[model samples]
Target: MNNPIVLNAFRFVLLLLAQVLIFNGLNFMGTINPMVYVIFLYWYPIKENRAVFLLVAFLLGLLIDIFSDSLALHTLAILTAAFARPFIMRFCFGVNYEFQNFTFKNTTKIQRITYLALLIVLHHTIFFCFEILSFSHILLILKKILSTSLLTIFLCTLFSSLFSPKSE
Candidate 1:
C-alpha cells in the first residue's frame, strides 16, 4: 500500500502541474474557471498533523498563486480551507472522517463529493473574496463565487470519481 504521505506529495505535484499547465489556460466567460487542483487538499489524509495540514495548504495555494500570478492571498485562502477542514469534515462526515486516517477506499462516492464540494466552495469563496478585497465590485465577486463554485464542483466530482483511491 502506498503511504498517505507519499501519495499526498505526489498528488500535490500533479495538481500543481495540472493547474499551471492546463486549467490555468482555461478561462470561459470570465466565470467558469475550474480549479480542480484544490481537490488534493480536500483529499489529503485527515489524520495528518494540524500544523502540517496548514503548512501544506499554504504551500499548495502558494504554488497556485505563483503559477497564476494573480495575488499572494491565494495562499491565505488555501490555508483557511485547510484550517477549517477538520471542522467541516467532522460536521459533514461525522467523526469517521478523522484526519490522517480517512481514505477514499472507506468512503462513499456521494459522501466524498458532498464533503469535497463544501471545501471547494469554502476555499474558492475565501480566495475570490481576497482577490477582490475592495467593495467596489461586490457584484462581480458574487458572480465569480457562484460560477466558480459550480464549475469546481462539477470538475471535482468528475476528477475524484476518476482518480479516487482503489483501496483503504
Candidate 2:
C-alpha cells in the first residue's frame, strides 16, 4: 500500500464504495452527508501531472454522480475543489509542497486539517449551491452547506489523523 499508484487506485475503489454504500446513507438531519471520497483527491501524489489530476477528480465525481443520480452536481463540486487543490496546497504547505507529496508525515497537523477543511468547505459549498438553483431555498441551502461542511470537515480531519502516518 506504500506504492503511491497502487494506494491511490485502492483509494478510488474504496472511497467510491464507501461514498455510495456507506456515507450516502448516513445523511444527518436529512441534510448533511459526509463526503469521504474527496479524500482520494486530497491524498493523490503531488508529482503527478496536473491535467491528469483534474481529469481524475472530474471522473471521480462523475462516478459518484452516476450512482447517486445527482446529475452533474457532484462532478461540478468535486472538479472545482480538485482544480483548487494545488492552490490550497501552496497556501497550506508553501515551499514544502514542492518537495513532497501531501501527507501527515511531513506536514504539521494544523496544516493538514486546514487543507482538508478548506477543500471540504469548497466542495460542500459548491454542491449545495448547485443543488439549489433557485433563490427560493437560499436559507436552506446555506444551512445545509454550513452544517454539512462542519460535519464533513470534522470527519475528514479525524480520518486524516487516524489513517495518516505521523512524522518520525
Candidate 3:
C-alpha cells in the first residue's frame, strides 16, 4: 500500500471519479466548480521525474475535459499549472524547495496555504480565460476565477490534511 505507483494510481482514479461524479454537478450560482483533482499536482512527489508528472497532469486534465465536455479548457489549464508548479514552489517555499528532502509536511501552514492558493488561482484564471474567450466578459471571468478558486482551495486543503500521513 505504501508503493508510490499504486498510491498515485489510486489517487488518480479516486480524484477523477470525485471530480466527474460529485464536483462536476456542483455549480454554485452557476460559477463555481470545485476542481479538487488539481490536488494531484500538489501532492505529486517533488523528486519524481518532471516529464512523468507532466504526463500524468495531462492525462488527468484530458480525462476531466472528456467528462465535463468542456473542450480542452481543463487540459490547457491543468497543464499550465503543472508547468508553473516549480516556480510557484520556489516562490512559496523559498530555499526550502531546493532541498531534495523537502516535503509539504515540513513547511509552515502559511507556506502550504500560499502554495495551494497560487496554484488554484492560476488554474482557475487560465480556465476561465479560455472558457470565456472574451475580454468583454472580463468581469465574469474574474468572478468565476475568484469563487471557484476559493472553493477548490478549501477542498484541497481539507483533503490534504485528512489524507496526509501522520508524523508519529
Candidate 4:
C-alpha cells in the first residue's frame, strides 16, 4: 500500500468530485469561486518527480475542463501551479523539505499560510487571466482573481487546519 499511484488516483477522484459538485456551485456573490480541487495537487507527494507530477496535474485539470465546459483555462492554471509548487515548497519549508512525505508540522503556520496563499493566488490568477481573455476588462478580471483567491485560500486553509496532524 506504499504505492503513491493508487493513493493519488483516489485523491484525484475525490477532489474532482468535490470541486465539480460542491465547490462549483459555491460562488459567494457570484464573484468568489474556490478552486479546492487544486488541493490535491498541493498535497501530492514526491517533489522530485516534476515531469510526472505536471502530467498528473494537467490530466486533472483537463478532466475538470471537460466537465465544466470551461475549455483549457483549468488545464493551464493547474499546470502552472504544479510547475511552480516545488519552488514554493522549497521557499516555505526551507532546507528541511522532504521529497517523499512532506508534512505540515515541519513548517510554521505562518509559512504554511504563505505557501497556501501564494499557490492559490497563482492558480486563480492564471485561471482568471485566460478566463477573461481581455485587457478591456482588466479591472473586472483582477477583482475576480482577488476575490476568488482569498476565498479559496480561506476555505482550503480552514479545511487543512482541521485535519492537520499535531507535532509530536
Best by TM-score: 3
Q: Model 1, poorest ten-residue lDDT window?
A: 97-106
lDDT ranking, high to low = 3, 2, 4, 1
Residue-wise C-alpha lDDT for candidate 3, range 36-60, written one tens digit per residue: 9989988887888999999999999
Residue range with the least summed lDDT across 10 consecutive positions in model 4: 159-168
Q: What is the C-alpha RMSD of each candidate to the true structure, in Å?
A: 2.2, 2.1, 1.5, 2.5
Alpha-carbon runs more than 4 Å astray in model 1: 98-108
Q: Which candidate is the best by lDDT?
A: 3
lDDT of 1 at 167: 68
Q: List, residue by residue over 93-165, the lDDT tens digit for candidate 1.
A: 7777655566656766677777888888898888888888879988988889889888889988888778767
lDDT string, candidate 2, 29-128, tens digits: 8857888887777777778899988898988999999999999999999999999998998999887777645455766778878888889889988998
Q: Rate the local accuracy (lDDT) of all candidates.
A: 0.80, 0.84, 0.89, 0.83
Ranking by TM-score: 3, 2, 1, 4
TM-scores of the models, in the order given: 0.89, 0.90, 0.95, 0.88
Q: How much is 99 displaced in model 4, in angstroms?
A: 7.8
In model 1, pairs of residues that clash are 46-99, 46-100, 47-99, 47-100, 47-101, 48-100
User: Which lDDT tens digits does candidate 4 get at residues 1-168?
Assistant: 346678678889988999988888887886476898877766677444788889999999999999899999999999999998978878888867754455665568899789888888899999999998999999999898888888888888987777543431
